[model samples]
Target: MAGELAGHAGDAANHGIDLIPIVALLAAAAIAVPIFKRLGLGSVLGYLAAGLLLGPSGIALIADPSSVLAASELGVVLFLFIIGLEMEPSKLWALRKQIFGLGVIQVGLCGALLTGVGILLGFAPVVAFVFGMGFVLTSTAIVMQILGERGELNSPSGQKMVSVLLLEDLAIVPLLGVVALLAPHEEISLTTRLISVGVAVGAIVLLIFLGRRIMNPFFGILSRAKVREVMTAGALLVVLGAGLLFQLSGLSMAMGAFMAGVLLSTSTFRHQLEADVEPFRGLLLGLFFLAVGMSLDLGIVGENWQIIALSVVAYMLVKAVAIYVIARVLKSDHAEALERAVLMGQGGEFAFVLYTTAVTAGIIDGPTNAIFTATVIVSMVLTPFAIIAMQKLMPKRVQPLDGVELADGLNGSVLMIGFGRFGQIASQSLLGKGHKVSIIDNDVEMIQAAQPFGFKIYYGDGTRLDVLHAAGAGNADLVLVCVNKKGDATKIAQLLRHEFPLVKVMVRSYDRGHAIELREIGVDFELRETFESALQFGAHAIRVMGADEIEIEEMIEGVRVRDRARFEAQVLGGVTAGTGLLLSNAEDQARESGIAPTVKLVAAEEKEERAN
Candidate 1:
């Protein structure tokens, strides 16, 4: 009895200890992320600093760092999944040259150079090769986050970086096989390696095929069930299931997760799946960085600080030089190439994964892993600063195409500001009716794609007054602000309303609030983009619930007309009404207009008619 009690107490104590690390990690991130963000250092650094403080090297609060690392690795897996979600198969195909050509050259050349250097520095051939392959990868998460935050992900250098990162990610699959083959006790032959590769590839193809077949139906069922929690669970199941299959095949779990994401990218559930997995990805990734900080062996660093420092500096310098030279050789301008090189110079998160795997497989000892891991951490820590400094030194210049004005003998009285999905549909309808439509867009890729479709789209910022004039906006009979951004739409509308009152302005409003804002600004027409679609959907649901089709249609039409009038009245009244006031007004208007009869009044009238 006493022994049982003691065992229970021990279990309780162990659980308590586990909770301490969780609390500490959360608190550290909560404090550090906002503080760093406020200081303009970005959240990646904040997470790293949090990990550093709570790590074993600092206060030594958490004794078992390995467990944290094991848990946090899921972050990297989810990160890859999100990346896969973003990369539609069509987009990937379009970027094939960059992915295959530039990406291949970057990895192959960098790995070869690093391998040569490592061998000269007294490492075994296998070890050097492993290091070369691993160190050549850049941090996709960090670089991508920074570029996306700054809205540069579609910029020239950003596109190049993305291509390289995608290839590097794909390369991780085969690289893992190589790392396994190089392990000391693993005597896997060439035949075995080939077989393993075949199995991995087969597994991936099978997963993607099956996923494409079932994901749509599965999500359809879940969506119809109307349980958001269940839908989220289904998404998690897909990601984790793919990861499991990859792990079983002796491949990277992240690889499988990514494949799953790519497969589901075209599904109707893509947006919801992204939303569901994003929080998990962000939190876990932060924890992964923290685990990295905690895992750093300070003792190894203290003993070999000088050599570690020199190796880090040398590693960054060599990689930067190699990237810059290769980019320039590939026909990129000098400034852009320099920017790309500087941005991607650091050792990646994969270094930790590779080194850890090597240590586990007995290919490299603990001391070697420590030195390399420390170097990777330091390099990653310095990446944001490096990017900032490089940006300051080489500010990104928006180079306008030389002498590329609107094509001769092409004129349209209708001006479409954005040529995205919304604008494209509008332009097509207008064109089909024998009405000429002039389109302007800022996206280079979009402009290029539209040209092949026989659309003469001008590439320029629509918000700029000069660009507007160049596009013949001055003589436009109607200005259609179909841009995705609310601010951009508002700006174009405001510009047209003040500059050319004769020209009718039609703006796409994102939501009710946006429509109100646009109306307040005196735009002639404001179409709430998804409002009609939502109403149609609602009408269908009402019909499904056994309402008469004609009744549903009439009701929907009444509501739509009344709502539009109410919205216009509220806009003109300059009153920011709450939901309660809005509902009250809607009720009063419905009763006064006789659009909807009161239940009590209807019942009383029926009773009186029966009596008569």
Candidate 2:
């Protein structure tokens, strides 16, 4: 009776103590999140910092890292699951060679080499295996976080990383399965395990075939309901149902979620679904990371600081160097390769879980486990510094095309170029607000489309100045270049700088590197045409039940804030600038500047609606 009472007391004590870490983590994260956002950094970085601060080895606020790591592992799982949900068979096949082949070779090569070093350092073979595999796994959390922040979550590199990360995440399941098969510690038969895997795969294939056939019709039925609430509920059912089905098949929940996502991807409403689920995904992901932060073990760190530090140094050096070499060999640009290396140099969250599991399973000893765990955590913490270091090491300068004009116009303060869908909207919006918008487009079709709209849309290459003069461009206040192509955007920006030196040019870019190129050429203001605002608004609207006007207004405000922030952050992070300077300078220049095109969108709509 006395022993039972003591056991109950011990359980309660541990539970109470566990809550301390959770509280501390949340407090720190709450403080850090907004501060980082104001500085234009991301929330993931903030969570990592919170982890470090709460870590027993650091501030000692949260001491039981084992428990923390175990819980935090779910964030990674859910992240991967969401990723799988995003991919379909056709898309999956397209990336198979890269994900399986390139990802396999990369992980294998990196792991083996790292393991060889561990062996030389006097660790056992099993220890080396654990260390090697753990180190080779890069952080999906960090990768996704960075992509989300930069609004490049759908870029080519982003897509490639998603494919690679998903394969790597899936590969973890097999690694454990294969290990268990090689050395059976459990009562389950090897044949049974094999059958389980086979069954999982077969079931997935069958569902995919059947789901594709039924999903369209299912969604069609919901659409006919003419009820948004019912449609949304039905959509959720499809996603959740498919996910649950995969889980029952002895596969990872993420794998199931991914298959469901893929099945849904075949639908015409794939983008809409992605749009629908994104808010839930983000909030869930944030909560997941918060949980991870709360799980850090402070006690372990205090006792093993030296070990953690050494392991972290070794892992970062090896992984970053290996990734840099691989990227260079793959023929990435010098700067791009360097950025890729630095960005992906950390040990992934999966490594932490794997290391802990292996240690518990007796596949690796305590010291080796410490080394792997500490290394991964430290590498993750150092990501921001690593990016800064890479930026310094591999600064890329954009060279404008030769013979591009430096200064040409004296009258036009703003030169609007490339008037297509984006351009027409821009011009109309600007005109609605009574801002003089000088329109230009290379496409004759665009000019023809604009002709009937009762706007004098000019037809010209925009590369030529005489044509620009005929359109009253010299008297314009600002240049809003909404061109689609990267090369053309660059050319026009450069040409304008040569010809219209006094006019402050606000240009649209393809992406970050493209903006960097424009910056190097000294474009006054550049905005990367990120698709995230739309995705972000859509996600928030569908999930949060945000009203239509509220959502539209949010998009407009978000667009302005995002554009303003991008402009300010880039310049501050470069040209030897600061955030205050960027903002003050931009505002001072645009103080007399009138309302933006987006500001007049409502009026334009009302006018057109009345006319119709």
Q: What is the TM-score of each candidate against the true structure?
A: 0.67, 0.61
Off by over 4 Å in 1: 1-17, 184-186, 395-481, 484-612
Model 1 worst lDDT window (10 residues): 574-583
Task: Give me the candidate number with maximum TM-score.
Answer: 1
Q: Write the per-residue lDDT of candidate 1 for residues 1-612, one digit (tens) a residue.
A: 334534654686777753555777899999998998898788878888888777667777665677988888788788788778867798778889999999999999999988887787678888887776778888876777666554456556777898898888778767876787778866887888788878888888889777878887898788778898998999889998999998888777877898899888776566579778989988998897788677766777789898677767877888999999999998999887887888788888777778888888888887788777887878888887887687678754545464234322335789888989888887877888887788778876777777777777777666655467667777889888999987668667766775578888899999887787677667889898888788899899999999998989876876676576667665644334322222235545778897784433332444598899
TM-score, cand. 2 vs. native: 0.61
Q: Looking at candidate 2, what is the lDDT of residue 199?
A: 85
Per lDDT, the best of the predicted structures is: 1
Instruction: Provide the clash count, candidate 1.
Output: 0
Distance (Å) between predicted and true CA of 289, model 1?
1.9
Candidate 2: lDDT of 251?
56
